[model samples]
Target: MGDTNIVGGIVKILETPEHKTFSANISVTKFRVQFPQFRNTSVVHLTFWGNLARYVADFYKINDYILIEGYISLRTKRISSKVISKSKKIEITVFKVYPLLLS
Candidate 1:
C-alpha cells in the first residue's frame, strides 16, 4: 500500500464527474479537481474514485475550498515528439476529502 497524503486548496476547475465501466462491468466514478499552487498558482489535478467520487462530484463546486486525502503518483509522458522530451505529470488519487472553507 502507498502512503497517504493530504492537500488543501481552493477548487480551481471542477469538471463534470463521469461514470465508467471496466471489464466485467465493474463501475467506478471518476473526476478531476484542479487546484492552484500557493505561489505561482499552477494547477494540480486530483482524481477521485468510487463512492467518494460521487460525493465530491455532487457536493463540491468551483472555488470551493476542500481538503483532499489521497496518494500521489507521477506519470511520465512524452511532451514533445520532435524534441524527444518527456515530462512528469503529478497526479493525486483522492480517497477521502474534508471541507475546509466552503464557498
Candidate 2:
C-alpha cells in the first residue's frame, strides 16, 4: 500500500486518560486546500498515540494555529460496559508542526 498522508489545519485538542496511559486529539481547522482537484474546507481530526501526548499538548493552545502532516484513520473499542464506541483517530507517527513565521 502507498503511504497515507494529509496536510491540514489544527482545530481542537482532546486528551483522555486510561489508567496510566494518555491519548491526544487534534481537530482540523476549517479551510480549503487542493487535494489534486477537489478543494474542501471540511474539518479533519488527528490523534497522537503513545508517548506523543506531551509533545502534542504543548503544540496547541485554545486558538493557536498549526499545520499537521500525517496519516488519517479511525479507532473503535469496547468500554467498561462492553459498549463499542468509535473515534476518529490518526496514528500521527511522524508529523511536522509549523507555527506562524513572521517576515
Residue-level lDDT of model 2, residues 1-103, one tens digit each, is 8765565554332322111242444323222122222334333344444444445454444344445666655445346757555543233432555554211
State residue 77's C-alpha deviation in candidate 2, in Å. 4.6
What is the TM-score of candidate 2? 0.41
- Which portions of model 2 show Cα errors greater than 4 Å? 2-5, 10-45, 49-55, 81-94, 100-103
lDDT of 1 at 40: 43
In model 1, what lDDT does residue 32 have?
55
Q: In lDDT terms, which candidate is top?
A: 1
Please give the clash total of every predicted structure, in order. 0, 2
Model 1 Cα lDDT, one tens digit per residue, 7-99: 544455455556565686545555555555554445556777666766776777766777776777776655455333476666777777888
Model 2, backbone clash pairs (residues 3+ apart or across chains), number: 2
- Taken over the whole model, the C-alpha lDDT of each candidate is 0.63, 0.41
